[model samples]
Target: MSEEIRETQQQPQEQTPPPAQETFKPRPPGQRVTMKELLEAGVHFGHQKERWNPKMKKFIFTERNGIHIIDLQQTLQYFEKAYDYIADLVANGGKVLFVCTKKQGQDIVKEEAERCGMFYVNKRWLGGTLTNFQTIRKSVFKLKMLKKMEEEGVFDQLPKKEAVKLRRKKEKLEKYIGGIENMNRLPDALFIVDIVREENAVREARKAGIPIVALVDTNADPDLVDIPIPANDDAIRAIRLLTSRIADAVLEGKMRREAVKLAEGEEADFIPEEE
Candidate 1:
């Protein structure tokens, strides 16, 4: 056979379309609370409350109208469920607003949020943060204006001695103006540490059609939250563990997304050649 014919025969034929990739369900977030941990928590704090009845022997965390309490095992299950729901939301491209009135709770929640690369409102939840995103954008715009003025030599036009003082004033104003960089965009969901204390923020989130995932103690109403995690709001250990579980879930969801992309790429590469 001629060399040209041999080379032609060796060449691959037309490729067939790749098969549709299978969708993967991501793992749910939050660590499982073992029965031992639940019992220990009950023993440590369950008896402290005068209202706690020893006969009931089943104390779970409860929340209603923003108040919180930890008394029952059912609360642990609630936390697990809430954590999974939040994880699913985050994995599916939803944003979350983290709100907490207490400094300790805010700090704990903020740390977990940062770990998961999500935004939070540890400070006071500004009114209309969700409802009136344009107003917040205007604030951010004002900051940008100040920065532009400084860069364009507007401050330099001032008397040499007064320029430094003017610059200091500008810096002070910018410092206290609050964060409005991403303010124009409202979160897809809200995760409140103390739903009662930050009720206004929660209400705004609700009005904007944002789903809420909140830590509900006995004192707060569970009805307020779309997904309520019943747990000890006062205990640092409990708070940290619960928040971390949610963060981990978000991370896992992100990983699953990346994995899906990779699988699609591999399948494209392996398409069979059509004769």
Candidate 2:
């Protein structure tokens, strides 16, 4: 009986129940986010060894499982530099064009950018948007005119097929330039996510002599950008964390701009008597 009891007790135990779920802890507002938070978002993770860009060798701190790891110190430093530059640009009446067309980043980019009243390209990047501005401006103008005409009941007078074609053309243009329609001139700077994926935007900005601030992964050429923040550009969480920082910086810049304008208005309001 004792031997049989020992055999039964030694039999494989049933699988243990899974661990209990943990509550989500939210980061506090206005708190200075730390490098540790950045790590939690996987910003230090990089691409495979084979895809590592030689120009980013200095930014790579180490490697694991054939993947290059970004130096968090360098990322923090570079990001601060970009943040300062963007703030100064916006405070001085400059505009920033955000380019993040990747699937994971599109919705995030649009929301963050719009929140700060900045422009973005979340859809297809229309070539020549910056380099050949005149032609693109013409199309944007036509689009606006068509919208006005529609509002005035002009489209109602057109033939059925002709109006349908016109509407389709307007939709296509909007898909390309709707976000940038309010921008009457080339952007003073461009903020790009995944420089490798949005290389066309990079090239166009370069062609137009515009400076670029980019979140560069290991697979991307960091030297191509004016300011490169080494990070995991593919992860949505990492992208969101960084872009949220940028959006905050932009909002701060806009606030400064408003303050300056208000001061100027007060100064202009004063009347000087004849001396």
State the lDDT at 155 in candidate 1: 79
TM per prediction: 0.67, 0.84
Name the regions of candidate 2 deviating beyond 4 angstroms: 1-33, 267-272
The stretch of ten residues in a row with the least summed lDDT in candidate 2 is: 1-10
Write one digit per residue (lDDT tens) for candidate 1, span 174-273. 5433333444477778877756678897788778888888766544566777877665555555556566666666665566666778899999999998
Top candidate by lDDT = 2
TM-score top scorer: 2
For candidate 1, the per-residue lDDT at 202 reads 75
87-204: candidate 2 lDDT, tens digit per residue: 7899998899999998888877887887777888999899999999998899899999988888898878999998888888888888778889888999999999999999999999
* Clash pairs for candidate 2: none
Model 1 alpha-carbon drift over 4 Å, by segment: 1-31, 35-72, 142-180, 271-275
What local distance difference test score does each model get?
A: 0.61, 0.84
